[model samples]
Target chain A: MKPLDKIQSIAAYLDEDAVDTDIIFPARFLLLMDKKGLGGHAFHERRRVKKGETPFILDRPPFDTAEILVAGKDFGTGSSREQAVWALADLGLRCIIAETFGEIFYANCFKNGVLPIRLDADTLARVRQAAGREEEIVVDLPSQTIVLTGDETISYDVDAYRKEALLLGLDEIAVILRDSGKDIKAFEEGQSRRAPWLRLGPDKWKVFDDLEKEQFIE
Target chain B: MHAHDRPRTLYQKVWDDHVVSTYQDGTQLIYVDRHLVQEVSSPQAFVGLDAAGRDLHRPEAHMAVADHAVPTTERTATLREGLAASQVARLSTNAARHHIPYVPMTDRRHGIVHVIGPELGFTLPGAVLVCGDSHTCTHGAFGAVAFGIGASECECVFATQVLRQSRQKSMRIRLEGVCPEGVQVKDVILAVIARIGVGGGVGHAMEFAGSAVRAMTMEQRMTLCNMAVEAGSRIGLVAPDETTFAYLKGRPLAPTDTEWDAAVANWRELASDSDAVFDQEFEIDVSSLSPFITWGTTPEESAPISGRVPDPAAIDDPRVRRRVERSLRYMALEPNTPLSGIAIDRVFIGSCTNGRIEDLRSAAAVVAGRKVHPRVQAMVVPGSASVRLQAEAEGLDRIFSEAGFDWRHSGCSMCVGMNDDRLLEGERCASTSNRNFEGRQGRGGRTHLMSPAMAAAAAVSGHLADVRDLWPEGTK
Candidate 1:
């Protein structure tokens, strides 16, 4: 995964609180085995203005060129459907800025290599206003600076570990692997000593052994 | 410390004590005590178990139930849907394989797991409980630290009985004074959500306390805790009181006589000390809270029942404004439209959240003399077989039937999209369940979350009218 340096273009802001996974990728779309076609149907209910015609959001100028989303608090609040994050990612939304995000959705965003930036209410308002004006909004990850075309800029805070993960394109699992260099072996040894029943299956034991080897080698 | 400076909130005390080891990555591996499992999401965890060929490390500490996918009609030999049938069957098999106690569909003890847990005394005060179902926070009413977990996390709990959690800052939400007449606990939670704007509780553990909270029954507290997730909090809790002890006194899993006495003594100490600290505190005057109805897709986008739908253009926040407009368009609701006159097609009055005996009694009281609207479809499902039997003995079922509601068996019918019980496309329902998420009741079905009495009132009126209007004069 390429490191995110800065965001250049702003998406026409779509604002909704608790935009659930169901609305993003409806249950009908879940039938499709391939995830590539999902981006086409992203926000399908909102895309059709008159059942057949493309909706205003899709036909609008900034949304057509936008690669980032500015959203409200509790953005993406419902079910733990990874497909929602996948749909956003496939739709070319590289970054999302919100005042707050759902616990699971925030994790999913990082896992899918999408930058979910938490901004203060004032900063988020500015970004939302900028999107409305079709003005360029720039977000420099390293400097934690959000700049609008009118020479307006704001600095936001990101957790150091999350920033590192986003920069390295590593997820929680990746971080676990990276950090568990010796811990995995120690955990396995403890498991073997404490609970012998966990060591019954050769395949099961091999799975843990493989995980240890993978993390140790890395 | 000043009088208000002391820890007057229950959230502060629980959070402060539950902090386990914080990882270098900023996440904490908080210890979890009780793990609750259900048919819907536990199957995936079992599949993970099969792949790993792992046995449950603490099977005795885990419990499973069939709730979401089971039918409310009857515990038949076979289920109507193949997937639903297979899921319930797998839960039974998996529970047996792992030595986890299970409340299967056919069992007389069966019901929504969250409902039965507290009633049967499985949810103890101060214990951390987690389930794959979102409303698992319902257990928090018993003063238990509870929240929802995903399937992968459920596996982690099954394997280790401990969740890798990031501890939240505590927020004490103090509600002073007595609740005004006709204002139910549901309204209190809604008012809190409305004031907090959903994300207000994010990264914060909310402890609901004060005179108003202490006055509520165990069932009412459960309803308040049930929607904690709606406020974007992982858990909602209240300190255990006399009401909590009374509710747990004689249940099957509750402590025996001597143990019960001892348990009560310990539970008394669970309250926050007068000098405990909290990260944040907010006070709400209970007298000001009114009956609330959600008008938009989200719970936070709500207003008083007598109030008009908010115009998105009037909102100062651009993000909130844009979403409100979109939600209004999708819901087919107009700005400034009167919420009272909107018609409802169905009424659902059962879930882990609000399917207890008291909730049924309240609904039954409202439906006693009123006939359900001619066009509306109404169903009354109890939380568990025990609740159903108790209601039947009290003739609550007859009142529900007379009012044109289908008095059905126990299960999480219509609350989630796992079962055959669902609202048809474009159908609007007055539901007593937690969550009004799009497609939660059914694909394209709209849900209006409310109290059971409010749902009953709507069933009779066939609209989103206020329950206060339906009550007899001087009754409140």
Candidate 2:
């Protein structure tokens, strides 16, 4: 995983709030069984383009170079449908800059390696203006600076843990595993001592023991 | 202690009792007593189990229902909506495979999961329940700590039988004086949401109490709690009272005979102690509230029937101003438009929120001698088969039919667009359902959330009309 030093691109701009999961990826396409081709229908309901649209959001000029989505308040408000996050991630949107986001949607973005950035109204207006002018908007994660093509810039901050997670591509489970490294071995030893029912037989035991032995050797 | 300090509301008591363990990170592991599952989110849980070769940890504590994706029409063969049919069938299959009790669409117990939980006595007082559906807060009317959980969290509960959660502070909303005629529990909740704004109750549990709430029926209490989520609260509760005990007396899973007497005795003690403390308190004068209607996209963006649509400029807060403007555009309403004269194309009076027998009865009473507007499409769907049967037995269904409304089978019909029942694009509807978000009913469909009686009045008048005017003599 690469640490995000600066976001130099202003990929695309969505104008509305509460863009629900149902519209993001309709339930009809849930039958796809795989995540492939989902990007084609990212904003199917609202997309003005016809079917067989080329390059999807990437086909649009200024949006093609934009790595961030500047959106309205309460962006992604309804439903806990994770497919919304998947579709956006598949579209290669690295970050979303909005005034506010739904609690579940914000959490899902972090889980899927999308940095959700919150900015004040004046900053949002500047980005919106830049988007209208087809100008490039740059966001520097480390410096917390968002610069427009007109030489104007604004600073914003994100939570430290969320910043680390996005930079390392670490999800909640990954964070938990990282924090529980020592606890895992202690838990395994305690389970073997007190509740051996949790332990596996010889064939499975070999796999576990081999891993434990490798850890000891390391 | 202040008046708000009495027993700290039911929300506080239930939330405090469910704390399992506090984590070093400030989150707490709250024990879930009953977990309701559905097909939409449970497939991932089963896949997770299959990957780990792990059996269900507490199958007995969990129950499944097919409601969200179930087709409401009477088609026996293939359904017009293939995805919905398959989702319903998958729920049945998964519940059977896991040995969890399931109420399929063909079963007598079939209905919205939230409605069935309380009807079957699964949502007992002081229990902590969770469902994949957001309206799970409906169970809190039974004095239980209930809220919605995400799919991954659902899997965690299935494996460990406990959910990790942080404790929330409590808010007590006290209603003084008797409820004025024509005003219902819906008006009380809507008024509270409008006053507090949508995020006022964030990170807190709300307990509804006082003279007004105490006088309400169990079904009405359920309606009040059902919209707690719209206020951004995790749970809403009313203390178990005589009305609550009476409603649960002959329920299928409720205690019987001597056990019933003992249970009532115990339930009576579930009220808050006189000296209990709550973090915040709000009071509303019930007499002042009238029949309410949501004119905008959000539930909190609502006003009384006689009031005019709010001007966005009048709202000083930028977020609220933006919401007001956006809602007006989606609803196609002018800033100063009177709510009374706004015409509607359809009327829907059903959902887990307000589709119970009491709700049906209230609507039926309004439409009994009236005729539905010829241009309007009106529907009344019962919450459950039991409610349907009860309405039919009392000829309430006939009253609806006589007024030219379609009285259909029980399901989450028209509340969400998943099923065949949906509002046409660009058509405005007066609905008794909880959400009024844009396109919630269907693509380009407009929804105005209201009470069942108000929906009934709108069906007859073909516009947003006050139900109080229909019953000048008041709820007799």
Candidate 3:
């Protein structure tokens, strides 16, 4: 994970609302565990004609070097596929500005060290317009502003806790375990005392594990 | 808070009970009741665990099943080629090493992670169920607060048998009437999605209530909760009742009669207190509902079977008009076209939503005395091996086969399209699964979400037609 303070780069564009993960990475490639290099297959149906071909958006000049992505409303609205976020990250996209995002997908961006910033329609349109003109676009997450060239800055919003987590390069697990070790221990101790049957030791666990593989016979 | 102010929703009680600790910043660590794992998501989490040099915290907390990677074809036993095979292999290796309970394909209960949770009696009321898959909300039918997590959260849950989440706002959708003749729970959910847009229920846990939902069977209840995710809600629930207890009794994982009575006594208190206050409420007159089929990419883009495709000109919002235009282009459909007469390329009658025996019975009734149209390709996949066996025992397989439907094994066959089964380019399909999103079934495949009976009717007619007109006499 990496802290995302500020990003200044050419921005790519995708203007379709509800741009689902199915199109972002497609289910065909979902079986691949490694998230690196998935950017090449991002938008497989929309951007590619055949193998070794860069089709519509990615084939453009400045977008090829984009570090920020500007998309329409409800971006990443389908399956909880983190591969889409990984694809953008692998392609060096640190910031994605959209009108709205799918709930799970929005949460995923924070976990993976990517920023999903919700911009109003007017702001989204202005950003996309700026990208079309090849103007330098800067997103300062810590500052909570989208900085364009010529001193124009637009305020942005993020979950307060999430913003702090991103600024500190912290994962949710790290944050939870840091302060809750005592609480969890107490809870576990109480649970064991109350429900002794649930405290399955390794010896007792094997009895249940074997039952999991019980086969069907005709 | 005063005594009069203490009627908490089920969401509140379950959420409060599960919280291990809360921080000053409103970040809470909640204990996970069940962690359902599949091949597609678990492999990445396993890779993360190895990279971090961390072992699984609690093997007993996890349930691993190779579902998404396996195909539903007659030829089972081995996985198909490509990442599907390798991913399943990774899951097996990881599960074996961690000593977690792995549901093998040979196991009769091996099925979609959501289906198997209840079938095996692992999903209980007043618990929290988490999975990497979005449809994990399906498990909420048993009164659990279930929701999907990303691969990163999966890894977190793998390393620690708990998850960190803020509480979601609570909502209730009350349906007050018996379903009209020929209407199924699938139709009810589709109509509900149509009324409330895809984002209507966002950031809320919707509780389905009223007399209609109370009358539903356990399987039908699962069907309704399954699509709550598609409506932009992570969790949907029905209060635990006698039906729930009866369905869960005598299962391999369920407790004995004495233990069950005690558990039920606690679960009885998990329901929303009378006069409970919800953040939002929506009521539906279920008797007025009709069979619905999605006409476009979004689940909200739907109309009843007798209705017509919506015209962009009729839309008031410009952004909505733009989305509908793009959807129409991808679907190759024209505005104002009668939904009933549109021809379909295929029919898929299975998935976590509509793959239970009740769904099979409904589809079987439609195909019993009719032959599938020669031009249409129809497939019937059970949700689990046990479901398949039950279908076979009741002769549903023969009816499907005789009517030109390909009867197949269970495992998320054509719904999300990860494995061998998928639709070709420019194909139009009537699917009994959730999500009508573009390329959901395959590349360039158009899906029309419908009920099992509607899909069966489409297969027999070679087009989208009203099931009421095609309903055979004496059918349930």
> i-RMS, every candidate?
11.7, 13.7, 4.7
Q: Write the per-residue lDDT of candidate 2 for residues B208-260, one digit (tens) a residue.
A: 88888888888888998888767767578889987888888776655567656
**lDDT per residue, candidate 3, B124-234, as tens digits?**
888788999989998889999999989999998887778778889999999899887778999999888888877777789999999998899999999999999888898
Per-candidate TM vs. native?
Answer: 0.81, 0.81, 0.95
For candidate 1, the TM-score of chain A alone versus the native chain A is 0.80
Q: Rank the candidates by TM-score, best first.
A: 3, 2, 1
Across residues A1-218, which tens digit of lDDT does each residue of candidate 3 receive?
Answer: 89888888888888778887787888888878887788887887787577677757766787888888899977887688889888878878888899888889899899878899998898789999998878899888878998887788999988788898889898666666666767877877886654332333465434355544422221
lDDT of 1 by residue, B279-390 (tens): 8788999898778888878777778888998898799977668888877876778889999989999999998778999889888878888999999999988999889999
lDDT comparing candidate 3 with the true structure:
0.85
Which portions of model 2 show Cα errors greater than 4 Å?
A1-43, A49-59, A64-68, A93-100, A106-218, B1-9, B78-81, B255-277, B310-322, B472-476
Q: What RMSD, rounded to one decimal, does every model reach?
A: 7.7, 9.0, 2.9
- The Cα local distance difference test for each model comes to 0.74, 0.73, 0.85
lDDT, residue B305, candidate 1:
85
Question: Candidate 1 lDDT, tens digit per residue, A97-198?
Answer: 887887666765765567888887777887898888878888788998888897887888777766776777643433443454354445445644532221
Give the Å shift of residue B321 in candidate 3: 1.8
Extract clashing residue pairs from model 1: B7-B276
Give the per-residue lDDT digits (tens) of candidate 2, residues A1-218: 23555667655776665555555665445433233456766676566557777544555775765678888766665455555666777777778888776555665576566788888777787888887777777777667778888688788877666666566654344333345435444544553453232132233212122211000010
